[model samples]
Target: MCDSVAIIGAGNIGRAIAEGLVAAGSYAPAEVHVTRRRVDRLADLAERGFRVSADNPGVVAACDTVLVAVQPQALDAVLTGIAPRVEAGRHLLVSVVSGASIAAIRRHVGPDVPIVRAMPNTAVALRESMTCLAAEAAHAGALDRVAELFRAVGATLVIDEEHMVPATALCACGVAFFPRAVRAACQGGIEIGFHPEEALRMAAQTALGAAALVRDRGRHPEREIDSVTTPRGCTIAGLNEMEHRGLFLRFHQGDHDLRREGGVAVRR
Candidate 1:
């Protein structure tokens, strides 16, 4: 278990991590401290027995593991606030702020502090996130610990820091992308005479099943597609129509655009 955890900027993503940790039995509510600019914003967490405060430095001083989940634009101020209180070799800093590099964070917090970057989608609320992590060679142990913590929430991958941005585009932004596809499918269902709620449920469950087939069976998605698309079938007709309309191409282009935009794909 974590000795103690502090989540700076107890916004949406930060709240998700905290809730997941507690729900997964990885940590007790009292063992986590969450800070927000306005302590009133953290009332729900406080009611759940988590320590809630507006003082970032105080929270950092009390915890061994700190998750920096602030907005990228607010990171500098947060780092500066907690820098003096951060004890080198004692505090493990993990940042989930997109577009902020380790080098920039180190410059603010000091070079001796171990830093890891993690990118997790909003799915973290359900403990079903796909989180990608990266850290410097010197911080490998810290990286592993960070990975272990996130694994309680969902799948985690350790990759080169250079790939962190791309991972953000693929996993973080891809969360929104996948749901949009589900919505489109729901719309199509509605057009075919299903009620909106029924269509949504059917589309969501189908998407879930498709994902589980690839995840659990470890087969290529094409294999599953092949199984469904028999000769001259309606499935193939729809698939061909979508392909011809460039549906998959649009997703690829969106990923490219996200990367080009420096992985600031979705606002926290």
Candidate 2:
């Protein structure tokens, strides 16, 4: 178990990770330290018993594990600030900052520190994120430890660093994509006369059930569709309509576009 953790730049992703750790009972709130430029924004975390401050280097010096969740643009400054304080062989650095390569981080922190890149969605708040991890061969042990920590909150996969960008588009960005589909379903339900609240609940639950079928049963989506679709059935008709409307094509296009743009597709 990780004895202590410090989340640098405790913004949305940072806060979500901290919440996931505490919610999973992986770490007590007091064992986690959260830092941001504005300490006032972290008052709630302090109230929850987490150590909160604006002193990044101080927190880095105190924690065993450090999660760097700052914006890509802010990464260099944060890394530079904390680099001197990071003790070799003592701190495990897990970065969630998008677009920053492991080599770039190493350049800032030096060669001896173990660095792992993690891509986890906001679903982490619900302990249901699909997190992807990547690290160099030299840091394999640190990667395993970080993977275990993330597994407390959700499923995890280890992949080549070269594939991390694509994984970000598919898993992290896919979080937003799936929710938008659910919202579209809710809209369709509203048009069919269901109350908005009821429609949203039903649509969300149905989506969950569909996903669970694929995950729990290990069935291909098309195979599951075949079981529910029948000749002259409404299911088949709706499926055809969605296909005709380019729903799947749009999703594929979005993935391609994200990849082409270097995986910086989502602003927030």
Candidate 3:
């Protein structure tokens, strides 16, 4: 494992990755070098013993693994600025910026530097993110290394680069969708007589339990859903009502729109 990392653009996702890595004992606070244009925004990290700076090139030169977390609009400038310092054999570039492909990044940093693209969602802060990773076949070793890094935070899946946009929709955007579902459940609970706080606790835990059943048991979600839904029971009734309201169609449409938008964002 690399002993140090430079997280460029230490925004929300970047900060989450930094905190998760340190909290997991994978890296010490001092080992993580974080950078932002406004260094004052990183005062908390500086106080926590992280090497904080606004100097992109300097930070990249100091770390072996460069994790780019900048927004798409800022990516070009950040990569171009650090291009001079990136050495092919000495550094690995792992990017969490949505839509920017390895080829696009390679253009800025040069062909020899291995680039891995990853998408980790909102749940990353809780160390429960489902991160999707991709790299060319020639960079498989780098891909494995990145996978190991992400596993310290949550699960990881390596897919073909072509599927990265859809992965963003399903895993990254899916975190937000699941919470909306939980919110709906909480609303239903309130209607059924539970107080707001009690309803939220029950709904969120139920959602977690449902996900765990599918994950730990390695069963299909439909199979798990079937287990709780007896023929004439309320469970089936609620499910049938949701289906009647086009739940499946709505969810599929939501994913499709997000994937489409992600592709558009990358092109821009």
Candidate 4:
């Protein structure tokens, strides 16, 4: 079993990781420690048996590994405050803060510490996230263990650190993008005579099944599209109409711009 883990900032993603780890049987609730300045915000976790506190240094001192999930602006203070407690050889540091480089963290925590950068979306709460991980070659062993921990909650992909910006937009922001697409489909179903609740369920299940086909069968999206669209069928007609209306074009161009611009800016 993995040693106790301390989540430095138990916000949405951190809390989700804690919940996912426990739900997956990777860690017992008591084995996880969570921290935030406002301890009241962590009452739910406290009730669930997780060690909750407002003391960052205390939590870091007790745990073997640390997952830093603080906002980019708060990172410097958090790292500096806990630096004294972050043991170089004994602790593994995994950061999920977008846009913060490993070198930047090393400045505060020192160079001997093993650090891995990870980006996982909110779907982690449901154990269906697509998490991206990256680390220096020297920290491969630590990275492997981090990967194993995430794989218990969802799938993991190892990618170059340079591509982490695009991965943030594609994987983290993607949770929102897919739901927007599903919402449009649900509206369409409602217009075609289905009740709101019925349309929502049908549209959601269809989206789920479509994603499963591509993921499970390893087939290209266009191949699946071709399989369902007969030359003169309504499916083909709707697809052609959508293409002519620039649905894919608009979404693609916008995403391309975002990626080129270092994937959405991390607000101060």
Candidate 5:
């Protein structure tokens, strides 16, 4: 039911949100507007029929919803620049910058404008993200719309804004880190005498299939794991080896230590 959406940055997260919003048919690509200094990187969006601009103010002034997607350090400056151009009840600000809070945005952008704090990981680009949503104190429905908007691209959950930083610490950053863990698992498969390409495919597909088991089976993952884990069978033997190496437990529970060695960002 949105007339237009403007994204204040053309970074990966911004692109994902814009693409999802437009692709979901809530609005057309022509109704989507994007701005960034790097004009070249916007070619894909431009080709998809979005209005690409280098002027954030021009874009922000024209849209019903505006997404602030700059880096955390740049958020204040971007807010300051766009504050005056945005009038009360005309634009609702949706922020995706990590670690920044809505109270801070209200202090910088004035009190009347509705504000939403949106946190989504890089998986958004693939339409498989898990996004967290929050709104300025007492500004209801703002958060719901934001959550629904993100649902077009991926799954979403609503939680207190105070939880966002830790949620970000756990998931947003972990999402990037999770892939490296997957790659490491694939490498381990290769070291165990499986051909590299075959091992990678098998590892990736196994992970995918395992996840689907939870979705398709409508039960906990361990239940599915237990289903195939017969007493002392080849699967159990392999399971025993994996358990001995801690790989089985670590890989599934999103283990912290195994993740740290793989370059997981635990904060910020």
Candidate 6:
């Protein structure tokens, strides 16, 4: 969708995005530019056919799309640095920094510039991330185009800006949440007398297969659960124990709060 994109920070998330863009062939190698205050971090992108520099204004002025990938705390300084060079209708600024709301960014850049607020997690590197987007004063085409850019990496959802914060906590933060559950599953492996590595492989594969079941069959999750839980089988016994411990309710409750804390710039 974009011939070139300028990334403000070449850090982990920013690098993932650049790599995603290149891998998906949406942006050519020379057309993608990445800028960072630290020169060393820019080398990786430089090697990948991307334009690299420490000059924010230059990159912002040169690219078709400007992606603000700075840390939450650094947003003010970063945005302030390039605000002078940004001319209305000249740049499309997309903020992938979490916890920062569009209203906040609008206040910094004014209302004329098209600002897009996004919540994309680390899983983007694998092209398996779930991303949510919200725009301030833009049309359906703008959102869809942004969605297409994000879809180059993984799945993208256009959601109300109000839900962006919780989406950050649940989906973005939730990417890290899955690992803890897998770790607990590994502990279960040890108790069953299997080597940690062996048990981890089995447990993780089972979970992977379950995910495939959801995507391939589009079966209601309950239907799959019923198929797995035999009459008083081990799966049911384990599930009953998890339910007793408040684990089931806990996950849902987390989702509720994640969605509810939508507007605050918690990333700050």
On lDDT, the leading prediction is: 2
Which residue pairs collide, candidate 4? none
lDDT of each: 0.91, 0.93, 0.90, 0.91, 0.80, 0.82
lDDT of 5 by residue, 141-189 (tens): 7787788788887889888987777667566766765677679879989
Root-mean-square deviation (CA) per prediction: 1.7, 1.3, 2.2, 1.8, 3.7, 2.8
TM-score attained by model 4: 0.96
Q: Between candidates 4 and 6, which one is better according to lDDT?
A: 4
Off by over 4 Å in 4: 265-268
**Model 6 agreement with the true structure over 43-158: per-residue lDDT tens digits:** 76678678999999898888768999998889999989888877777777899987788878877778788888878887787787789999855555567778888998888988
Task: Summarize candidate 3's per-residue lDDT along 84-120 as a digit string, tens digits.
Answer: 9999989999999888999999999888888999999
Candidate 3 residue pairs that clash: none
Scored against the true structure, residue 90 in model 3 reaches a CA lDDT of 93
Question: Model 5 clash pairs?
Answer: none
Q: What is the Cα-based lDDT of residue 220 in candidate 2?
A: 92
- Candidate 6 clashes: the total is 2
Q: Of the candidates numbered 1 and 5, which has the greater lDDT value?
A: 1
State how far residue 252 of model 4 sits from its true place (Å). 1.6
Q: Give the TM-score of candidate 2.
A: 0.98
lDDT of model 2 at position 98: 85
For each candidate, give its TM-score against the true structure.
Answer: 0.96, 0.98, 0.95, 0.96, 0.85, 0.88
Backbone clashes in each candidate structure, one number apiece?
Answer: 0, 0, 0, 0, 0, 2
Candidate 5 wrongly placed segments (more than 4 Å): 189-197, 216-218, 237-268
Candidate number with the higher TM-score (3 or 6): 3
